[model samples]
Target: MSLQQVEQIISILNKQSKPYEWVIQEFHKVDELKDFDLDLETFELLGLAFYLNQDNCLSLKTRTTKIKEETFCIVDIESTGGIKHGQILEIGAVKIKNSKELDRFNTLIKVDQIPENITELTGISFDMVENAPNLKQVLRDFKLFLRDSIFVAHNVRFDYGFISKALHECGLGILLNRYICTIEFAQCCIQSPKYKLDVLKELLGIESIHHRALSDALAAAEIFKYCLSKLPYHVQTTEELIKFVKTSRTQRKIAI
Candidate 1:
């Protein structure tokens, strides 16, 4: 589809003032998108616009001039765990530029089988996700969801590690995006002894619903925002913040 057609869809989306999902549904009805195969840039742009409409995130505006226009995708995964590697049952993420939510995506991933204990803990039964999109499709969709954005998560390393491994196993390239761990930033910025999401949420008074993908994404986004507010002024740009996070462990090692 032509950019003009996409632009028109975006325009309609911008004017809708509806919830994000409704807008997505409406946009899908557009003639161009009916059979649309979005090129990478178009998909990213569309995704950004999708999140700009969120009420919770509208208050945090992007200062594009102050930092690189590079976006950040805050991610959370739900899985069957404590193995060498485990099955990812769900994926959730929200993109942010400046401080505003740009776009979001969440998907349930169908695995060949789910363990019994795994089903109990997560309430994600094998039958529930049986007809859901497989890992390959979900990852492809997520990679598109995250295009041009730095990957971020609470602990961050685990989410990125799991995703990197999953993508590689699917014959897709590992994500080369820069990343920051909110947990690391929390250690640097907050005095809490523990940084688990629920613990930190209680300490910060950021109420969150548990286990669901979008809820977890929202909680991670909140934690990230709190950390951003606490960072030193010198670490203003995305590049500078990345450097600070990269060197944070070195500083801790020296102190130890």
Candidate 2:
């Protein structure tokens, strides 16, 4: 679709305050999107970028709902620190439900060579992954393991971005899993001088083999459980937890 057409739709949304269904009806008027194979729900999902109010289209705002009785996958990855330019060396994750670990996935990815700095930082060397499976195979396996669970990580964006990019390059497509960053959760729930994963591990007395993907992921899982316990009693669903974390972070930033 053309930029002008998209702009026109946004303009319509801005001027007309209507329900989400009404917005879709208006979107149908657009020539580009009219023949689009996607359905109304899919189209509304895209409207999330515009931050449209599902109930009443007024101003742009983030939308989050409840997430009770859902599964979570805490994930971590060790890479060359240049995901866009370099390679992923390892991936580790743990699936959790009802605050209990359901399963685990850990693997080393074969790479041409591991950079000296990366090896020093992660303790994963060229020799370690030389015989391991390639990125395509590892990503395929990880995707199956991950399924549709909510993705959790210390600094979620980093791991999520790297994995998403790796998957795309491997022809696996983008990751669509909803994700929560423990860093944000910790900031909202804990009182610590620093919110780094290692620092939290030390403060909480959680044993960890720092810099390894699985170890870090396990640590993050612990932190996530702790944060969940500290959440308001009313915050039960995944959507509520996410919204609470984001709102709390914003309030903390304003306080600072």
Candidate 3:
């Protein structure tokens, strides 16, 4: 088994009713070089440790069944304006694995500039952002959070394009992660004439609580879950889902 799988199995065992601590202690009882010296009945002792533990073996078996599934980091951003040229004011993302929300990343960012109208609209004044982390720092943390998962967002090009640009400006390389656009995913699954987030959320009964970074991120995560429920099993892997995202029928424009 992979090391991560081993770690997860250990975690599961720690939470269960089984005598896992005793099993771990039994393994420790055999000193590293001592086992080699104990040339006393090699095959018998080998069978002893391996056979005295049905619980340890069963925990591993359960976790192996779970390793085939993949996870996604659903994201959303609230910016000063709709344009990619406009700076992002806040960002939020949630990791979903095996139908569970596992991790989260969220932050408000300091922007280089913000117009009075944007300040009025988003309540994100320049002074408010002055002390916040710059895009570079924020992107660094975001990159660590995103590590190799499928990225999902509503109107994904807008969020993804701005993120790619921000990361590039920070001297970080472009993110080539497989991505899924909820707007397009909905269009494909539900055939909506209009797939705006609020529109689709209202139509589908997925409520948007705050519409700010975390709230929108949660809503987008729900939308992504809905899309996943509709997709076939073949599109389950991160790479395969990215392929589906790339071929989505929605018209997405690349920001200049």
Candidate 4:
């Protein structure tokens, strides 16, 4: 399908609360799309983008029959907070399978300077990263480390966006890995007054240091596991879980 057609499909899916099967049926009704051969993966990717656009939650198709069998790479990053202009100071990720942590990746990027305020926040100083590897090298290694595992974070957009942009600048291109947001999942799965990582850390009694990348990533991973355990029995697949969370958020907004 053409890029425009894919975008149109994504737009329609975003504005309406229809599942992939229903959306595909409606798309087939269009004379233009009727002749086009679109595969299940393309449709699912577009549907995945619909939710990602809503709040940076991207779910990819998984061959695993159960959630526990799937692999998740829970990631977190500490950056200069400059968005387009800032640089990433550190990256941390933990790979989990079958609800158990299998491995971890952590690194600091060399930066010429870091603001005092940022240093104060993350306790990462310019001196610390001065001798660390460059962005390109770190990203190269990180990309390989990530593989095809599902990308996850507390607020997925910020971390994922920064990493994606950095990768592009380093000639690595955008990350197509499906992402999940613990913050969004927590809002859907738990009735919490606040869903901030620190708040949830205290509320859920998860032991971890705050602010640092690895610790925060570990905290998010814990929350993710907890949320999965609380998911409805019918929500088994990744796609179903994404739909359930999106619908729950919509219902909550309407109630408010």
Candidate 5:
């Protein structure tokens, strides 16, 4: 699926208000999404989540949920090198609800080879993943663990884009969960010389192994919580937080 299409879908969802009105049953018709397919395939390929409400109308889950009640899955991955040509070597994630971590998903992905440079960076050698599960299995499991929770990462786009690409390559659909990028979100909350995961890790005094997937994911989770605590009173819904990091989307880019 085209990534641009997913972005377009997100724009539509972001603009939706009082989600109940969009429910087909309530309106006796599909409005904004009349031409949009809300099927499983569409949901997976677009990285969005919606469900049939008690009224039997489809409603966007993230839009209605309060930020304090939302669940977030902070994710990080280690790959061979590049998004286009590389393979994911490891997947690590932490599930957060109400600012606390409740569970984690961590696994190594089996690959044919590991480049030396990648090994030097992440310290994950081919042998490290030699006995691990295959790419498709790991991704399938990750998707299950992810559920409809928000997909969060340090540089949201890279991890999100890479995983979406990897899933499609494995014949799985793209990720449709709403996501938050710690890098951009941090910029709105803290003053830092740089917002790289490692840079913020040091500035924020977050302790973790620098390059490993789980460690990095934990570090990003810390950053995610920090940013949340700094959010203005006006921003309370999950959709508001999702739109907060992108300056153009929110009323004003918050800088503390």
Candidate 6:
């Protein structure tokens, strides 16, 4: 219902993952918990809108799905500035299934202002967004394109956090999908000196435009697949793959 509620779902799962009973009780809302029927209806509504699942797991697809079978939405966004006040100028995503790009979504969002420096960096002026769809409509469409896939982005926190906040602002609820940062994921698998999408794209010889959303998303999709090939042999399930990148900080420190 709220960002905090979605966050509560994620926090509980990361700590004590399982079915509804264990998680619902922890919410201090056991009175609302039921083994079936109405409870499932509630969760199904949450799941349909926010990616929460009937199993009470926020990352329903990531829990047991194999890495090779999972569909990853590699995304990139050009925003006006900071997440707190900025608007998304553009958003682009590449849906990757079995290490191949299966679908794509790209759109500019209508806005009235964009800082000069932001314009310089992303080449996205207010004029460019003038005729585009509003953020709410774009978010609703993006949600449909996103489906239940794992979200991937270079600096995932910014994109994921920003989009989640924007979605909430648009009354779309927060994203409950599992996500992975390519920078973190790359650290676990590659020896790149820099992890910025443009930097890694150059290092990896991925040819694409630098700042635009769709081009960058395509580049990130390449990076995601490239890094996937380098993952430890044991990283089979989507859970293990997500876990692998998350534990990268400590694991990479050992090599340093």
TM-score: model 1 vs. ground truth? 0.69
lDDT of 5 by residue, 84-110 (tens): 888889999999999998899999999
Name model 5 segments beyond 4 Å from true: 17-47, 51-56, 248-256
| Local distance difference test, each candidate | 0.67, 0.73, 0.63, 0.72, 0.78, 0.75
Error of 5 at 37 (Å): 10
Clashes of each: 2, 4, 0, 0, 4, 0
lDDT of 4 by residue, 134-235 (tens): 999999888777865778999888898788778656755456555688888888766678989989898789998888999999999999888887777887
lDDT of 1 by residue, 59-149 (tens): 1112232443657789999887732458788999998877688888988898877788877766778778979999999998888778657
**1 versus 4: better lDDT goes to:** 4
For residues 85-135, could you state the per-residue lDDT of candidate 2 as single tens digits?
778889999999879889999999998888898888888878888799999
Better of 1 and 4 by TM-score: 4
TM-score order, best first, reads: 5, 6, 4, 2, 1, 3
Q: Name the candidate that leads on TM-score.
A: 5
Write one digit per residue (lDDT tens) for candidate 3, span 36-66: 3222133122211112245543222222222
Candidates 2 and 5 compared by lDDT, better number = 5
RMSD of each: 12.3, 7.0, 14.5, 8.5, 4.9, 4.9
Per-model TM-score versus the true fold:
0.69, 0.74, 0.64, 0.75, 0.85, 0.82
* CA lDDT for candidate 6: 0.75
Q: For candidate 2, give the lDDT of residue 187.
A: 89
| Better candidate by TM-score, 1 or 3 | 1
Cα misplacement distance, residue 201 of candidate 2 (Å) = 0.7
Error of 6 at 53 (Å): 12
Better of 1 and 5 by lDDT: 5
Ranking by lDDT: 5, 6, 2, 4, 1, 3
Q: Write the per-residue lDDT of candidate 6 for residues 53-93, one digit (tens) a residue.
A: 66654434455678988889999999988898888899999
* lDDT, residue 162, model 5: 92
